[model samples]
Target: MYVPNHLKWRILLAQELKQAYFERENSLRNCKRIFELYGRYLLGTTYDTFLTYLNQRKYRIDNLRMPPYIVAAIGLLEPLRIASERLRLRKMGSPWTLQEIVEEVLTILRERSSTPLDRRIGQAQQHVE
Candidate 1:
C-alpha cells in the first residue's frame, strides 16, 4: 500500500529529528514544538496525540540531532504540502472522500520515503529546467 505524502512528511520529519537532533533536550523540545504545531495544522490532531501515536508505534526521537533550521523547514513545508495535495485531489475529482485523500497521501509517503536525495534533487531540477 502506498503511504500518503502528508504521512510521509511526518515520518520524514520525525525520522530526521530522531536521527539528527533528539540527543539534546533542547533540540528535542524544538522538534516536539515543531511537530505539534505543524501536526495540528495538517492532521487536525494535537501534538500530544501525535506523540502518542508515535509512541504506540515505538517511534522515538530521543538521541537524534536534527538541526533547528531543518526542523523549522519541515514544520513550514508540511502544511503547504498538504494543501497542494488537497488541491490536486480536488482537481482530479476522483474519490473525493477524505479517506481517499488520506490513502493517497499515505501512498505518496511510502513511496517518497525510499526516494534518494539525488532523485529528489533531480525531480526539482526537472521542475525548474
Candidate 2:
C-alpha cells in the first residue's frame, strides 16, 4: 500500500519518539517515556509537555477509557507522584526501576481491564510472552 506523505511523517515521528523513549535511562526524569508508552490510549503525550501543562489540567484520567486501577497504576509512574513531597511514593519503594514498574502496570491493566477488546489484547500479549 502506498502511504501518504503526512502519514509517513507521523509514522516517522512516532518511531523517533519511541526510540528516544526506549533509549532514556528509565527514570522519572525521562518524562517522555510515559507519553511514548501510553500516548495512544491517553489521547496524546501527557507527560511530554507536563511541566507547562501541569496546572492546565488538559489531560483527564477519565479520557483514557480504562479501568481505575489501570489508571492508578499508570499514575504511579508519573513524575509528580514520584516527586511529591507528601507521598514520596518513589522513595517508598525499595528502588526505582522503570522496567519493573512498567511491567507491573501492564499486569495490573491486563488483570483489571473489563472490556473484551482489552482482554483479547492481553491474551495475545501473554501468548507472545
Candidate 3:
C-alpha cells in the first residue's frame, strides 16, 4: 500500500488538457505536497494498488494524477501473474490441484472485468462441440 520511492514526484508544472475538468487553481496551490503514487505501489502506479479509484484520479498537490488509460501487456502480465502466484504457492508447499488452480486463475482474471462474464473458458460442452 506504500508508494514506491521512484514514483513519488512533485508537480513542477500543471497542464490541464481537459476543458475545465480540473481546477487549474488547485495545481497552483504553492505547496510542496508529497505525492507517492499511492497506486504506484510497484511500477509507478500499475503493478500494485492501495488507493481507491476515486482517490487515484482526484488531483491534489499531494495526489498522483495517473494517465487516463494505461496500456499494459496484460496478456503476458496476467499469465506471468498467474505463474508467479503459482510459484509462490509452490514454494510455500501449498497442496496442489489443477482444479483449485483453475478456479483461482479464473477469479484473478474476473477481477479485471468490471462487467459480468460472457465468455467460457474450458467448458465440457465446448470440448464436445
> Tens-digit lDDT track for model 3 on 34-94?
1131123222332213223223444344554534432223233344456558756665876
The number of the candidate with the highest lDDT is 1
lDDT of the candidates, in the order given: 0.57, 0.46, 0.38
In model 2, the runs with Cα more than 4 Å from the true position are 1-28, 45-50, 55-67, 70-129
Cα lDDT of model 2 by residue, 6-117, tens digit: 3333333333334334333454555455455544444354454432333333333222343456444444544333343323454574664666555555655555565688
Runs in model 3 deviating more than 4 A are 1-77, 83-91, 115-129
Q: Which of candidates 1 and 3 reaches a greater lDDT?
A: 1
Residue 65 accuracy (lDDT) in model 1? 53
The ten-residue window of minimal lDDT in model 3 covers 11-20
Q: What is the lDDT of residue 80 in candidate 3?
A: 44
Q: After superposition, how far is residue 49 of candidate 2 from its true place, in Å?
A: 4.1
Native-to-model Cα distance after best TM-score fit, residue 71 in candidate 2, in Å:
3.3
- Scored by TM-score, the top model is 1
TM-score of candidate 3 relative to the true fold: 0.24
Per-residue lDDT tens digits for candidate 1, residues 1-129, read 655544545654545534432334375476576565455664566667666545544444344455688766654364446755775767775545666655666666677678999999997677555
Provide the TM-score for each candidate, comma-separated: 0.29, 0.22, 0.24
Give lDDT: candidate 2, residue 6.
36
Pick the winner on lDDT between candidates 2 and 3: 2
